[model samples]
Target: MKKTALITGANKGIGFEIGRQLGRKGWRVLLGIRNTLNGRDAEEKLQSLGIDAVFVKVDVADPDSIINAAEILAADGTRIDVLINNAAILEDRGTTINTPRGLLEKTLMTNTSGPFNVILAFLPLLGNGSRIINISSGLGVTADMKDYAAAYSISKAALNAVTKQFAAALAGREISVNAVCPGWVKTSMGGAGATRSVEKGAETPVWLATEADSSLTGKFFRDKKEIPF
Candidate 1:
């Protein structure tokens, strides 16, 4: 049977790269885009490469949109073999003390709440042997060297916590829940000066999706190496 995969915020950036890679590997990829125009563009781009790609509008910050998408998938009785929660946003890259409440809220809503929302909404769609790959960041590592991105860091840290929660809840069901730090890639979000390319940045997520060991669950990876939880 052809494997089904859903990639959130996949219209572009690391999400787009993940879609391309997974589709090329013969998975049926659902690109979860927020806008119809961007969704169509991404679908066309993937189709040009002869991928079995479809676009579904999913605004992570909007619970209604997430619910609707879940309803459609549930109606179709679709079993998502892989779910890549790659949708994220960077708001106000500023110091910890100087970050405004508005920026923190927006960042948490998107980077933190968004993935958790998708997980809850799509829980029924995930099946035994399924994989949940959360695209996280090194900045979220509270044990690592601290950064000034108060909002982004805290949001991802929360994501890390959520990853563990899902892993525990899904463990008996034989589903694997994992998180990966894509590193600073040269995407629009990562900026032109970022060290890594999209391809390089997507390596860990792709690996966790397709090649991770069965023993590895509820873990964090950076560049294919497991990091401290």
Candidate 2:
């Protein structure tokens, strides 16, 4: 049977590119989006390109939404081979001193807690040899931490920790869980001046999802190479 992958925030940017590439590789791609209209549009676009793509309504920020999506997949008996936690937000680019408390909380809610909740809801569908790719960032690395984008950075750091915890928890099950930094891609979150293209940004995650060694888990990666967290 063809493998299946679900990518949150898959309506655009690197998430969309990951879906497209994985679909091209003959994997069934589930486009997880908050908006039904956008998800349908993305699904249709992928289908137009001869990809087996489906739209799954998922709002990672909302626990109910994540649970609903998991229920839908469970009802369909969808066995997810890969789960990409690509949904994230960069609400405030300000320094730690200037970033609002509400913005930090909101950022953590979406980027960190949301992925954790999704993983929990869908854990049953994932089995041995399954892959979990959490989209993190270089800013999340404490060794190279900076002051800018404090909210976004902090959330991603927490996400990396989540990856490590899950890796340990799932070690006996043979499920691989890791984090990848897509680099400074030219997405809405990365802005217009970023250097990398969406395809380039999606490459590592796609590789991790399909081609990386199953034995490899609980690591941070960038450009298909391991990096320090």
Best by lDDT: 2
Model 1 agreement with the true structure over 131-210: per-residue lDDT tens digits: 99999998899887375888999999999999999999999998899999988899988999999999998888888888
lDDT of 2: 0.95
Clashes of each: 0, 0
Q: After aligning candidate 1 to the native by TM-score, how far in Å is the CA of 227 from where it should be?
A: 1.0
CA lDDT, every model vs. true structure: 0.91, 0.95
| Candidate 1 overall lDDT versus native | 0.91
Native-to-model Cα distance after best TM-score fit, residue 53 in candidate 1, in Å: 0.5
Best by TM-score: 2
TM-score of each: 0.97, 0.99
Task: Quote the lDDT for 18 in model 1.
Answer: 92
